[model samples]
Target: MSSSSAVKRLLNYAGEKKILLILASIFSFFSTVLMVVPFGSVYFVIRELLTNANDISAIPGDRLILCGWIALGALILGFICLYIGLFFSHFAAYQILYNIRVRLSKHLSTLPLGYFTKGSSGAIKKILDSNVEKIESFTAHQIPDLVSAFLMPLIMIMTMFILDWRLAIATVIPILIGYFIQAAVFSSDSGRKAMEDYQHSLEKMSASGVEYVRGMPAVKVFGMTMDTFLHFKSTIYDFRDWAVSYTKLCRRPYMIYLVMLTSILTFILPVGVFILSGQPDNQAFALTFLLFLTVAPSLSTPMFQLMYLGGELQKITEGNRRIDAILNEKPIAEPVHPKVASSYDVRFENVSFSYQEKGDQEYKLALKNVSFTAPQGKITALVGPSGGGKSTIASLIPRFWDIEEGKIAIGGVPIQAMATNHLMETVSFVFQEVHLFHDTIEENIRMGNRNPTRQDIISAAKLACCHDFITSLPDGYDTKIGEEGVFLSGGEAQRITIARAILKNAPIIILDEATAFADPENEANIQKGLNALIQNKTVITIAHRLSTIRHADQILVLQDGEMVERGTHSDLLALNGLYKKMWNAHLSSKDWGLQEREVHHHE
Candidate 1:
């Protein structure tokens, strides 16, 4: 996105909240203008004193006291305006951030799951957390500060010129030189590149940190050290190195800017003496010079801020670009007129797909002209070796990734024609890789039905054979997962998920090795639950254990994304093809016994 467009898009996300920012800037501008009052008051007081320097008894105490009160009041009023401006900006920023997060989550839910199929979650999360967070700083602090920073300097400069043009020129020249020097350093190609590197390192470090935390279980299981997660460790080092390098790169320039900006009095002092040489007793000019000395120092705050903002603009734009990319991504279009399925039978006709687009040389078709009809109220088992399209076929049933070659329909309605909400409701899955939230057991089971009653959840758990184990716990159904002593065995966790599916009672159920994690006893119990779940439901079961689906209505054997065998258990065995070989392998694996042998070294 163009820098202007990126900025405009960030503002657009604020919607009506943009007006709050405008109000903030308005208040901040006037508050900054009010700051000139104190300068004037200082001048009046100094002039009063210097005019009667030779005779202290003649000095007007009331006038000096009045000047002091007015200056103090103006300073207090300016702070109030600043407070109001800040209140508005902060409110708008938080609300804008919330709105952006909500919209992003809603938009993502509509898109096909393929958008986050691989390792892209880190990048997307960075967009949501860091990229969106950058706007908070921009909108709240920077916007109001920017208005004051620009105008306050101009007001001060104009006031300086009005008081005495020669001193104004003298004061502004050093400021102008300091600004150019600071700008030169900030705008340098090398500095920009270093800043980019620093930002890149931060993103990498953050993403890796997230990934590292997620892999903690595996790290602990394998007894791995910090060195084992090389990528995450390396990102930390890279971030540190880049941060130090960038700081060092800008250290000299920043110091130079600070020195130049602060030394305005050095320039003014000499010039003030030169001007005073012409009229030594001229107290009016002497008082004006004193006013310049007092007020000129305040310029450093605004001037430094202006340069800081210039650098901040670059950072904000870069972050906004990442945000813009996600917001612009096209979601899977909802059907203009959604089709409702009358029945739950799923049919895939001449389906073809790859992880990437077909034109890419690296892409390999995961499914090729794969066609089948999993009839309503019957079980269809998918058996295959690893990466032989078992999981891919199961994923396609729910339209996780849209098929480009052919139609995948449910009850004669194309899946693409059905609304995403409708499709999700029709299919329930108990995946091999189980995922339970950190919520209570009841909440986890309640995920099946959006608004299930307490009795409904208990009934579903009973059917899944987890009721006994759940009630045995101290909190019963309310026991939180991932808590101390609440961590369940794999079998127990898988059964709870099965209970969730039973509660959902979707017309079509996909079981991707639901019993994969269960022991012999747990597998038997899970099978009993499966028996209750599959009754009168259109079921698609993918199993590595051949015996689990030995009596399925029909068995479809898949090899290299092709439907090689389709028949009953006996028929496939008689054919003596891939299914028979796989069956033999499964039987042998189940029967295999463990034995220990003594090692004898023949040296």
Candidate 2:
């Protein structure tokens, strides 16, 4: 995005709460006037005291009292206005920040699932959390301060010009020169590169810190010590080094600006004295010099404030760029005229897909010309070797990745035509990896449906065969799952996830070997529960164990991303194909186990 565009976007955020912003700007302007007025008041008071101290009529007692009162009032009012400006500015800033965060989150939810699949979670988290916070700091504190900084100097210079133009001109020359010098320093490619490097290093450090903390358990389990985690520490040191390098580059220009400002004042003081000493009217010269001395520092204050805000402004620009990238990403296409699907049977017609990567030409097709139908209200099982596109096919049904060629439909309606929420509402998937939030078991199940009553939750758990186990716990349904359901065993966690799906009560269900990790005892219970859950629902199950899918309505045999065979269990067995081979091997293992158990019992 262009700098102008970024500034416009920032202004737009403020414009949303124009009332608070207007109040802030008004108070800021008044604060600037009051702040600058004091410099002139002090100068005039000192000048009058020096020039007419002995003359009773030259400076009246009432005028002296009035000047003192006005000076005191301006000082008090300046601080009050500044306080009010700060309040309004921060209020508007936080509101804008809140709006940006909320908008970004809402946008993320609407974006294509492929966006998240291709992006790093850690990098996105950094942008949404830390980077957004940095922008907020700039908006809340530095931005308002910058406005006041600019206004104070301009007002001070104008007041000085009214007092005496020559001295005012001299005072501004140093500031102009200082500004150019600062600009030159920032404009250098090396300086910009250094700052960019520093920011990147900071991002890397944050990413590494998150990774290191998350992997600490694995690191310890593998007997890796604390020293192994020193990567994060080293990253912090690298960031610090980059920051110091940038600071060193800034030092010379900062010193030059200061020296030049001092030298300009020195040159102006003597020149003013020389011009005034020879003039018939020396009073104007004396007053001008006094005003110059008082106003010079205030005029320079704006430059320092600009320098302080400059770094923050750069960060805000970068942050906005990151945020805009996500907001600007194209969402997945949906059909113009949506087809309403009435049944749960899913079909893929000549479906082909190739993964697309940013800035890469080579596309790898994960599935090719795949066509199959999982009939409604029946258990259709898929048995495939690894990398045979089993999970890929499952993901496509939910439109996680769009196909390059043909269409996938539910009933007769193309899945693409279905709204994302509608698709998700109709389909429920339980993968091998189950994730649960850090909340009570009841709450987690309730997440499946917003207003599920206690009985609804218990009924779903009962359907998953987890209600008995849950009730065995002290808190029953109210038991906290901890983070990602860490407190639950693998089988228990899987059952909870199944319970969640049961609660959702989607028309179609996909179970990717849901009982693959369960023990024999738990597997039996899970099988019983799954039977109850799938009674009236269309089910597509991927099973590693051939025995589990023996009674399925149809079994598909896949190898290398292609369907090798598809038929009922008995038909495939009679054909003596891949399905028959797998079934025979499974039966042989079961017979061998039974024989061993019988021998042990006899002994």
Off by over 4 Å in 1: 1-11, 54-60, 137-143, 180-196, 221-223, 266-287, 309-313, 358-361, 599-603
C-alpha TM-scores of all predictions: 0.90, 0.89
Give me candidate 2's TM-score against the actual structure. Answer: 0.89
Query: Model 1 over residues 1-603: C-alpha lDDT tens digits?
Result: 444565576568778888887788888987898877888887887787778889999999998899889888988889899889998889888977988889888888877778787545777887788877887878788878888899998998998898899999989988888778767876677866776786678778888888888989998999977797899999989988997888888888788888989999999999999999988988788888888888899999999898888778778777776665666777877899999999999999999988887678899888899999999999999998887899988888888888879889999999989998899999999888889999999999999998999999999999999999999998999999988778988889889999999999999999998888778999888887888888999999998889988899999998888889999899999999999999999988987998788889999
Residue-level lDDT for 345 in candidate 1: 96
lDDT at residue 59 of model 1 (Cα atoms) = 90
- Residue 229, candidate 2: Cα error in Å is 5.1
Number of backbone collisions per candidate: 0, 0
Report every candidate's CA lDDT: 0.86, 0.79
